[model samples]
Target: MTLGLTGLLALGLATSVLAQDYQRPSISGIGAVAQPEQIAAWDIDVRPDGLGLPVGKGTAEDGEALFADRCAMCHGDFGEGVGRWPVLTGGHGSLTEERPEKTVGSYWPYTSTLFDYIYRAMPYGDAKTLSPDEVYALSAYILAENQIVEYDQELNQDNFAQIEMPNRANFFADDRAVSEAYSERCMSGCKAEDINIVSAAPELDVTPEE
Candidate 1:
C-alpha cells in the first residue's frame, strides 16, 4: 500500500533517529565513540622529557618578531610583563624573598612546560592558534630572555630535551604516599583542646544585619 506524503516523512524521521541511536552504543547511549583522529588532536600534552614535541624548529631571533606582534601587549617587549600580567623573566634568586617573583626563568621546572603551555593556551584570548614552529620560536625567545638558552639556539623535537630548566633540581617526585606517616582517621577530637573564639563576626562589624 502507498503511504501518504506525511506518513513517508514520519517514517524517514523515525529511521534517522533509530540510525543515530544505533551509532551510540555507550552505556548511557549519549554519544558515539571518539575516532582516532579526534583523540590524537587532543593528545598534545608534552612531557618534561620532550616526549610529545611536534616536528618543528625555531630560534630566539625567529621568535622575536612573533613575540612583538602577538605577545608584547601582555608579556612586554622582553618578557618583563605588562602592568599586572605575569613577569616571564629576571626572577632569579628571588624565590626566597618576601614577595617572590616566580617568573618562568626562576620557578619553572621544565622547558617542555613553556612549549606545552604556549601551544595549549596563549596570546591571551586567542588560544591554540599558534603553529608548531611559532610555538617553538616563542619558547626559544622566552628561554633566551631568561638567559637559559642562547639567542641563536634552535629549539626542536630533537634538542628540546637537552634544554633543561634552571629549577629542575628543585622539583622532586611526589613521595607523600611513602614519606608521610598516615595515622588513624580522626573525625572528632582532631584538635588537641576545645576551640575558643577571640572575636565574632558582629563584633568585627564584617557581617551585615538583616
Candidate 2:
C-alpha cells in the first residue's frame, strides 16, 4: 500500500515520538557495599536439624503469658484462631476431609519448623523483634495448646530436637521420577457428583456490575 504526503508526515511524527520515549539508564557505579555485621543481622535462618538456634530458654508456663500479650489478638487463647485467622490447634483427624484444617500440630512435620517460622515471622505486624527466649516460650505454648507437650515443658536449643511432631509420619522423602505420573493413581471419591450448596456469598453486593 502507498502512503499519501499527510500519512507519511504522520508516520514520521509517530516515529520521532517513539524515539524520544527511549532513554538509557546511567552507568554510574555509586552504591555502598553492605558490611558483615549488616549481612549477619539479616542471615537469621534456622535449619531442621536444630542448627542456627539462638541461645535462650523458655517454658510453656512463661509462653502462655507472652502469647496472650503478643499473639492472642490473632491466634486466640489456646491457639484456636480468632476471626478469619489461622487455627493453630485441633483438627487432629481432618487431613482427608473435604475442608482440611491444617494446623501446626495436625500437619507440620517438625518442631524446628515451628520455631524457625515464629522466629522469622510471627505476631503479624512485628517481624524478627522477639528475643530468642520469647520465641522458645511461644513455641512451647503452641505445642502445649495442641497437646504435643505439657504446660510445664521447657524448650531450648538443647531439647528442641527431642520434641517430635505427630504428623511426622505423614511426610516422606521425595521419590519423584521423570516417567511417573499422578494420573495413574486412583483417587477414590474424587468423581464429579452433584452436591448441595451449604454456604453462599454475602447478601451485600460490594462488587461493581460493570
Best by lDDT: 1
Any runs in candidate 2 off by more than 4 Å, and if so which? Answer: 1-36, 173-210
Q: Give a tens-digit lDDT track for model 1, residues 57-175.
A: 99999999999999999999999999999899999999889999898999998888888899999988999999999999999999999999999999899998688788778878899
Cα RMSD (Å) per model? 7.5, 10.0
What TM-score does prediction 2 earn?
0.68
TM-score, each model? 0.69, 0.68
Poorest 10 consecutive residues by lDDT, candidate 1: 17-26
Q: Whole-model Cα lDDT per candidate?
A: 0.91, 0.87
lDDT (C-alpha) at residue 117 in model 2: 88
